[model samples]
Target: MRKLFRRQGEQRKIRDKSDLIVKSNGQRNSELEKGINFYAEYLKHLDACSSGASQLSPSDEAHTQNSDLYDGKATFATTQSELLQKLEDAYQRESNLEEKLKEKIKSYQELKEENVSLNKQIESFTTGQTKLAEKHSRDKRALVEEIVELQRRLDGLTPSLALKEAQIARLETEKDTANNQVRNVTNQLQCLQMKLDEARRDEAVISKLDLERRDEMDSLRNSLKRFEIEIEDYKEKERTFAEDLSDLKRALREAELLGKKEKAIAEKALEENSGLIKENSELCAKISLLEIEIAQLNKDNEFRKMNDINLAELAEIRESEKRSKLEVSRLQEKLKAEQERLHNTEAQFDEYRKKEEEVGQWHHRTQKELEGLQTLSSSLSNENKLLRQDKLTLSDRCEELQNKLRKKDEEFERMRDEYETVSEHYRKVLEKLELETALQHERAGEYEDLVNRVHQLSASLSRDDSSSKSSRGKRQTASSENSSGKSTGEEKVQFIVLNLADLPVR
Candidate 1:
């Protein structure tokens, strides 16, 4: 029993030390220890006083215990004025606590009003973000429609290009035929040139034959004159030479006939040669015309080749246009993807902002709750302190009353035992109260740690938000630059297309 009492006393002393330390907040441990030691010494003094009083009159203790449970009231009358003064002080402390509570409630109401206004502002921002998102979606839809139309136009243009290619192929075939005709005409001109050379040689031979015929006729005429002279000489011989003269005349006649026949043959040959010359001149003129036609055909072929080059260039231009169109489409797709990512990012940002706002609101609420809980804990601590003081004074009065009963005799012995039992029960209650206060202190520490962690998390999230905003700004600038680049590419494609259009078709 003594050991239990000692343990209880030790526990009470420890509780008092912890309470004093808590009340001091940051005061020195030495002060707390001194306070605890002083309380322990006071408790020991009370115990000594009670022990001395208990031995005074143990015989009348039972009778005193049975007489009146309220008999100690008259004995406590001497301390009435002091008790009234303590009560008045307690009322003042209660009123002060009430005023502080009212002030906290008013501040809580003001915080609630401010939170509502901030929520309204947040709602307006969200609505604006939503509107901008809608506009972006509409723009995306329009771009998609425009792209589809361009694709349709490209599809239409493909068949025209094919038809143009077919026409070019036909033009190439025509050019080949014209080239063959030119080659055939050139071969004919070469053969005609050889024929013209042969004709010139024949004309030279005809002129040489005409000159030999003239010389032979001149020689025959001279021989005839000599025969006539001989005839004349023979006539003088009269009758003897008559037969010879007649023979000579007949020979002269025959020579005359041969000369006439030769003249006719020469005329006929001259006529035939003149006709051949006329025919050759006609062939030369035809050859000249054919040469001119061949030259024209060559010029036409050159033109065709140039047309082919132009067509090839046009086809190349078309290919480049197609490539540009594909690039544009690809860029559009990239833009679409970027827009989608931006949309997703915006959504995530909005969600993060919402979560941050919620966290801020939660932090505020937790702070308020913690403050209220702290105030309640402090009030409870103060009440516990006052209750302990009251209990100490009551215990001192009870010891004095007990001592008086002991002096009254051996009849109060049973009352003393009952009082001890009641005292044991009260000690147990006080120990339980101390344990409860200790649990509250531990809970308060946990709440403080939670608040600190919340603060740290909020700071980290704020940093992340700032970085995201900067990155988003960079992306916007990059997107603008890409748009400018695409516009330039489109301009180049348009210029190429226009140049291709201006090229002449074969």
Candidate 2:
């Protein structure tokens, strides 16, 4: 009866342990399901973040386009508008992503709470398992004591229980089956422990992934902030460029006005030059007339000398000659003044050429600026074309100016050659006048010596007359010879004066 009670108690204990193991398995399965569901939620969040990141990649591409725009490569207002739209869309998407992230974060928090609860539950389960193991050990010790007591009873009552040996063998088989069930329950508990460890490892992996995702999100936010700042800088640069364009336009207008003024000034200068040319032609005519008059005066002077003109008349003629020389000198001074005026004009032309060169340089600079502006904005293409046309016109004007300058230089060279010829002519005239003056001085000395010789011959003739008749004949012959010599000398002097007067007036 005691053995039967012990067998029943052992069977009950096995059944209870199996029930506890089954309940632990059911709890473990429920916890595993919760963990799996949490993992699924985490995976879903990860997928959402990945999708958001994928969407952000396009935004980054758009940002690159924005960078290109900043580099002055966009279709102006249209591109700006499109970029604004894209930015707004990106903002919306980011907002949506932020909301999703917030939701995901909240869910992650919930999952963490659930994980904490699950961990607490797992710990309680482990404690329950430990308690159950301790209880099982105490029960096993009691069972061992009971078995010892039963063995002692069996030894004591072996002869009497000989007829119940088959029943005892059957009880032994039941105990062996209970032992197998207990071993299976222990193996199931160990499997549950392993499953719990695996769940913990999975949770650790999920937390690590969450941290990485948070880091990525932070980086994305930083990048977005940088993009916003860059966009602002682009806006400021655009404003500055617009201001520069306006300034360029104003400068171009000013240049046009200055060009008009320069044209007027050039026209005035041309008129003045024409007048000066007319004056120079008149002066050349006057100089030619003066040279003709000088030649005439020289011929008249020679004629008067041949007619035995008085010294006072000669003095008056010399005074007239001096007046002519003074006039020639005045003409030369006027020519010099004209040359100085030409030099001043040349200096002015040089200044004008420098100004034109400066204008061309300014034009080149403006063209460069315009080209840069054109690159910055496609909307300015038409303006650039117009500017190019203006440049073409300006270039044509520059070519015309250069041609005019060449002509002016040629004219200046001709004028200089003419002036040089006139100066050489004047120098030749002055040399002739100097030679004529030296000849006149030598003729005067010869005339004075002939007059003194005439006086001496007349006095000698008078003395011969007062002395003897025979001597008077010799004196007359001598006087005749001297008179003949004097006549020859006077003819020679007249010939020389005529030759001098007849010299070509170059």
TM-score of each model, paired residue for residue? 0.21, 0.37
How far does residue 400 in candidate 1 sit from its true spot (Å)?
A: 1.6
Off by over 4 Å in 1: 1-309, 410-506
lDDT of each: 0.53, 0.61
What C-alpha lDDT, on a 0 to 100 scale, does residue 18 get in candidate 2?
49
Q: Root-mean-square deviation of each candidate, in angstroms? A: 78.0, 80.0
Q: In angstroms, how far off is 351's CA in candidate 1?
A: 0.3
Q: For candidate 1, lDDT tens digit of each residue in 229-277?
A: 5444444443333444455456545655644565465455556546655
lDDT tens digits by residue: candidate 2, 341-416: 7677767767776887788789789989988976876544444455556556655655665565566556556655
Clashing pairs in 2: none
Off by over 4 Å in 2: 1-198, 310-315, 378-506
